[model samples]
Target: MTAPVAFPVVTISDDLALATACARWRTCPAIALDTEFERVRTFWPKLALIQLCDGEYVALIDPLTISNWTPFAELLRDPNVVKVMHAAGEDLEAFLGGCGEVPAPLFDTQTALALIGKGVSLGYGAAVQLYFGITLAKDMARTDWLMRPLSDDQLRYAVADVTYLLPIWQDCAQALQQRQLADWHREDSEFAARRLQQQEPAEFLYRKLKAAFVLRGQQLAVARELCAWRETEARNHNIPRGHLLKDESLLLVAQKMPRNWPALSVLETLHPRALRVHGQAILNAVERGLNCPQAQWPAPVRRLLDVPNGKAAQDAMVAAVAAFASTRGIPAELVFSRRVLENLLLAIVDGQPYPPPMWQGWRRAAVQSALASELTSFGIALPDWW
Candidate 1:
């Protein structure tokens, strides 16, 4: 029987010690990294601790004490080193926000497990159970990571995050390599990193506001402008957008197209606090949106289900894709999701290029050519992004 791998943990609260540590570890081919942050009642994540391990050594760096991170930032940006983490979305965000760097060449264990038929979404503790048959210590789900002088238990919990990550990644990566499924992980990891690092315009955020889905033309325009305004205000003040203006009230204001404060005061659902705090700004945004040129407005979303007898069309396409995937001995969803399919269909309808998330790396090589051929049956062609 093989002995299990274990690592020793060390803490570095001083900035100079962490810089030297990161410099020492830069030559490593791979490192397991994790972060502890607090996001309650704030727009930006408050980074508290960063834990890193290179198979043999683990270091817990105190974010509060480390002001100079030039060396650490360089380590994060280095392409030769792979940073392994489980569900690294928020961790990436914290690194971007706190350290002013985006770590790359990532090996996300959660994505690896999902690609290899483990599960769709696995938490850190759950992943530890699946990979090592070792149930993790009790959930530190509600730890106040921002508190100074973290308790011994808290320190242990933070250190434990990176302890198993390196081994789990090694095991998973070996399996992926043997099965020639490494591309799936590479594609997924790239997609995650791109999403976390991309700095899209604030106006683009309007698309995520569900209430805007019901809007069109000038209403959509107003909602978009207000959304941008909210984002800018929240970022400047380091506050949540909802603290500036709730989405429901924001959409309501757009719908009402209130000309002034007198008109805005009548919204039954809008809290008086919001009206008092951001009323003029909201009015100004509405004015700007209403005056915006037609060319500036975003194209309306075309629902595939809205077309007459469209359900049959959707079903036929899904069945055809599923059959194609089955013939190749791969899961249909793994090849292409229904959402991506619909986005392609709508883009074709509007003559706009569709942005396919899985259009690169091994996914593109394995699936794109065949998937494009399949879509042509429905008189839609694949965009180059695929």
Candidate 2:
């Protein structure tokens, strides 16, 4: 903590160097990993550089030039070599899309720190300052990583991200072990990595649209159809989905289900470009949705969040779980995030026939059998098959 750590930055611009570094990484116990990617203009991120470190050495692999990612993918899949990163969701996305791999035995320093009760949601630079009293530069926040021949300053900034990761993870892991919460971090990392690695279908992307769940059967159908169409159109054109059609505008069209451009153009939410180029296609999708059979309508989007009972049942369940967690000294957020708890209530409200994560693995471990007993006391039973 007394000294600023320094290491030589090895730039790997070709296949040979990348292969060599991958081979070396496979032998290391753990490595620090980070990436720089361009995501401003496209639906999919364009990976620029991948930075890795193993305490003593740092390597910046140029993803722009390297053609064969097999070696790197193998290294990432290796179970023995832990990949340490901070807030790794987006990086995981880029890796799955670019390299066909998701780093296993992953130790996310951000998750680790939060699990150990060190910080709630700390960024890489703030974490470094808190743990080692070293302030990292922020000048490279929006740099054009896709540019060739990165400046010396950019390379330096990139390498600094991974250089301290190993030491920081070590400290956090030790803290977790001291508190007998090491298994908690492992559970979270594996669970998060699994979810990140899976590619959810774009058709379901409409579920994320604001207020999409509030629509009734036919209206929801139109929104889903429009959302799926926008997803496909955006990807085929390699442009941002909003550039093709905004979510607000899609919702407006879904509600109105206009049969012609003039009718569609009447909505204030419709963009000029969207109406000019894609208006007819949007109308076609809406017509199909309008004729959709009642059985074919999608489930009410997250309707449980607005359950009419003042959600007294849901409120009592979350409060019971919170009190139970307090007795076991588990961090309330880690046991089941606020969102997870809400989703669980939403599922129950919708009569979903399965148990949510809160009723399984880590949540059960933290609360013993109280969660189940609390629900049983309400005469509510989880399906046995679940």
Candidate 3:
């Protein structure tokens, strides 16, 4: 096995230097891009290092040194160049949030690897090791990117990340195409891009609310109000949304219907600022929920898992999916797996197929027949109403 290539680190110190580097990098048909940022203690990821490679050269743009991102923004907006990344969700978010733009014609190596049925989401290091026979040191995985004068080892690690990404993507892409899995990757990439475009702080409120099923419409209204309040507070304070108010805390507040400051303060999870700044608003929401008529209450949102005889069907589906996945040498999670299986069974009980199109692909066919048979055993056939 050949030793891994050492990436030449170019630290840009001035806007002119950045523009010059970007211009030079843009000449390549495709560039592998990656970003290192600190997101642990802040709402916005502190972009510390930006890595870019054009097969011939790799450059690391130090955000701490270069303040203006006009050059980098142009690179992202350029449709001609394909920006490649691996497991790039947070990195893409950080870039778009910082520059108000996302890279077009983007390719994600991790997604490509998954489409080929190469064990569900392969880590970059693992993918590299499997395909290229190179071991990457992960000592810098937790390094503080916000720190200046980054050590030589850290710089080497950062550069190595993008240096091999292009080759790895090339190999994975060819394999996917040969196996007729290219379209799946393409569809998934478009879906990811759409998701990145749709990211909004306000929309985060409705995610993963266990009480959403039992809550009346007016209670939902109160929850929405509280969630919105928390989102705004977090953004204003430049802290995590959970730091302002956790989902559990918001649900508790909405459920308890505290009518006054003392009562609101009694909720252990309530942030002090939430009680101080929006205490009156919280009380008003609770009162509105309390006074809401039964007919005006929001209808109970039905969960797929809540259907009659759903658990048994779900378990059978899980087993069938696992068996299929094992036969195909892919991870069970790549097929229907646990979460997707439960979701599919729920969908089936809700008058849909065992596995919806969202879970469709090459590997899916292996399990679909077994899943269909299992659903049949439960008196639930494909495309039949519950």
Candidate 4:
């Protein structure tokens, strides 16, 4: 049986209450922060509530009632105050959308756990249970946070987010200090926070589409144009990009380079709503792509599995990273993910920059030697700087 714990909940509704809470929080050296939002059908997350705890004080600040964010924004920008969170990616997004800024000097418990060799992708509940032997109820996870007058269970769940986080932050900070990886955690947390706020340029977005590797030359250009148009349309309407047109349908259209409605109608994956709403716009994008100069065409993206000897090199690097991580007490996934290795391989094949930031900083000392040895064995030479 799980032991019941007391959480003194205080609701900050108006601007004055929120400002007062921020004033108190600014004095604390470290505080736990979390946000509840809804984003199921929209391009951006809808900010619902902000939860905060500083060991002794717990408060839920309702964004619906607060207008003046001057005090809270100052608290976020305060250098002395360290904001701690768990799996802060989406929460960071919520903060950016809500207040046009994100917390710096962030200490993400999930990232800290991975650096300590515990695990990557450790959810808050798992971390709490792992460290405190407490199983939290997740029944309120899917509740409508934007609704007026939230239920008791909803408010309790919100408080619980930051309540256990305070202790988890303490434990994680201690572990990081003991392992001498506090700087690494700080660097990664800042990078992740910044990355969450970045909007990838639409022109380059097609490179991330599924099966983009299959399209080349004019076909690739078409895919790029189509994706760029979809991105603009989605953002303009505040709907999901996928809801406008699925990737497979876009890819199919790109492959065929359809010029007319009849030609586009043959694509079974293209939804009827898209055809009725934006059919001519899609054809115009296709025409523009067809008329694009040869020099403007995007190069085909190559996957390691599709390229000769690429898979072997990737496997060697993966093994090297795993072996190095095992000895250094760092999670291998944290050291280098599959996507990172793929990007590294493409850079090497294209004779582009040898080492991206993934191979720099603390990671350079951890896995560089082993990875370099693997590449040399495969007859690949690193850039002079590498």
Candidate 5:
């Protein structure tokens, strides 16, 4: 058996040390990277720790100690070197949001592992344990990486994360190549690279409350107006959107169209302060809902799918996809999961072109074929289903 490699923990304390570490990383062909951040109470994540390993050496950059970030940021933007991270979504967000750039030529080990049927969305600790039989210590997860005079144990744990990652990636990459699934890894990496721009408006700000769809056009108009008001209030206050008004409360207010402060005050879901401060505006919204013309109301909610047999056709397609996933030793959720499969089924029944399956390789093929047949049965032919 190959002896385990010991990782040297280098804390970047000066500009020279930081630059030297980046220079080493820039020359290396690929490096494993990870970050620690706190985001519980803030709009943006507070980056506390950054860990990088270039096969031979592991360097832990303490953000609290070093202020000059230009050297590290330049290395991050370098496209020649591949950056590897396990489950890199939030880390990528922090990097882009902080330094205004994301690393190019990025490889996500978790995605690569899933492509070869290792496990869907596997945790970093689990992946390392499975491949190396080395159980990683978890005590440093909630440690204050932002504090100075870091303990020896915390430094060792941080270094170990990326040090062992190099070997784990090599093993996983080899397995993927043997299975002819290397292209899947490439495509997934590309997909994750694009995730830096796919931010969506929060659902609470846009989606109508559950069962709010049952209301008439005028009621929906009221709901939309109230939602717009609440969204603006939440932003101006710099509080969570729900802190201003819950979706259910907004729906009820729109439905009832209360004519007076007393009537609105009776709403159980309304926050006491919201009623005290904006009760007049709430009444105005209710009045607008009551008087808005039918033609001016928001459009009706469209059904997701319109197949000939609807639910029956959806059931058949789902079963087919699930069976195909099982036969390949991959989890059915990794293929389409129940939620995405249901949406896809609805789109096919509605005569809409199927959306790209999130999974790669044979699983995507299985989902596409099943969806295509369902669409054809509804007299909708999709030539690009392949």
Candidate 6:
């Protein structure tokens, strides 16, 4: 094991200190960034701490003390400086919640690694070990960042996140350039940053449920209303959705369209406490759904298996995509995950337009060229623009 290097750690609890750091950060071409937050029980992550490194300086900014996040948020939005992070999905969410803005012109080291064929979804610690042969301790990973008076171990863990990130990003950036994958990495990293910051509309939330396809017409409308209500309540209470009402219970209520308290009370999956408290609200949601116009009801969702030849076509397309990615030394999922491909397949089968973003830029050529023969065999033709 390599001896640990000591980087200066400065804590910024006040606005001036943070502003000073931001001034320095503005001059840098790129900076490593990471966040520590508590999200186990809450719908929104409680921002606890922010860490940053720019090859020379390391700073731990206490989010609890800083009232003004403008400086930091501006730095994140700066077009000149690239914000670097590893596996930045959750961190992007944290930034949106904590700083009111996500980093633009982002460089995600994990995505870069996948582009360079290092590994898919390699974690921060593993990447540190891979690039620098330093095995980081995991003891402080689960420490409470919201607590005042953080322990030395906790501080070390937070600092270490950004400490090694800049170097890993440099290596990945170099490798991406060598492989002519810089454009691909940039597209993916920016997409990831934008994607995570988006909030899924509550009315459309039921579409995300796996069992939603089983319901149709009015039942689907009821499910959508219940889902939207649950989403709103969860956010208002700042509690996890399942903590209030489990999905199964919601689905059952939608399916039953229970009218009276006794009817709603019969669902075994519905918790006793929830029934006692939100029973009327749930019933009201059901009433609203039932009164909804038939034209406004959500269209029935068909199971993939219900579609003729859907299974075989999905399987063949998956194999073709995998084979195409392998030949180019790219992670297949990076192009399109199995779940995404399934959705795309379903959309096509329904005569809907292909998702515009997925078929743009480098991905368009990759997918079209890769699946040309397979698509032809299936009697499917991609749009000429693709």
Highest-TM-score candidate: 4
**Sequence-dependent TM-score of model 3:** 0.81
lDDT (tens digit, per residue) of candidate 4 on 1-386: 23226667788889888887888888899989999999988877878999988878688889998898888888887889999999998888788778867897799999988888677899999888887787788999998999989999998788888888777777789989999989999888878776676666777778778789889899989998999999998877878888878888899999999999999988766679878888999999999899999998887777777666888999988898889878878878888987788778766764543355466677777777888898888888787657
**What is the C-alpha lDDT profile of model 1 across 1-386, one tens digit per residue?**
12246667788988789888888888899999999998877887878899999877788889898889888999998999999999998888889889988788889998777667676667888888776677767757478998878988888788788888877888889878886778767878878878766655776667667655677888888988999999888877878888888888888888888978889888765578778878889999999889989988777655776554445546665776687667655567766677766655655554555454445566556555555665666566555544
Worst ten in a row by lDDT for model 1: 350-359
What TM-score, over all chains together, does every model reach? 0.87, 0.87, 0.81, 0.90, 0.75, 0.89
CA deviation > 4 Å runs, candidate 1: 1-6, 201-203, 235-237, 268-273, 294-299, 320-331, 350-366, 369-386
The true-versus-predicted C-alpha distance at residue 287 of model 2, in Å, is 2.7
Error of 1 at 124 (Å): 2.5
Per-model root-mean-square deviation over C-alphas: 2.9, 3.0, 4.3, 2.8, 4.8, 2.9
RMSD of 2: 3.0
Whole-model lDDT per candidate: 0.78, 0.79, 0.73, 0.84, 0.71, 0.82
Candidate 1 Cα deviation (angstroms), residue 27: 2.7
Candidate 6 achieves a global lDDT of: 0.82
lDDT computed for candidate 1: 0.78
Off by over 4 Å in 5: 1-4, 13-17, 65-68, 143-153, 201-205, 208-311, 323-330, 346-366, 378-386
Tell me the lDDT of model 2 at 13: 80
Q: For candidate 3, write residues 48-77 as lDDT tens digits.
A: 888888887788887777778888899887
Candidate 5 C-alpha lDDT tens digits along 266-297: 87677788677778877886787678788877
Clashes of each: 0, 0, 2, 0, 3, 0
Per-residue error for 348 in candidate 1, Å, reads 4.0
Which consecutive 10 residues in model 2 have the weakest lDDT in total? 377-386
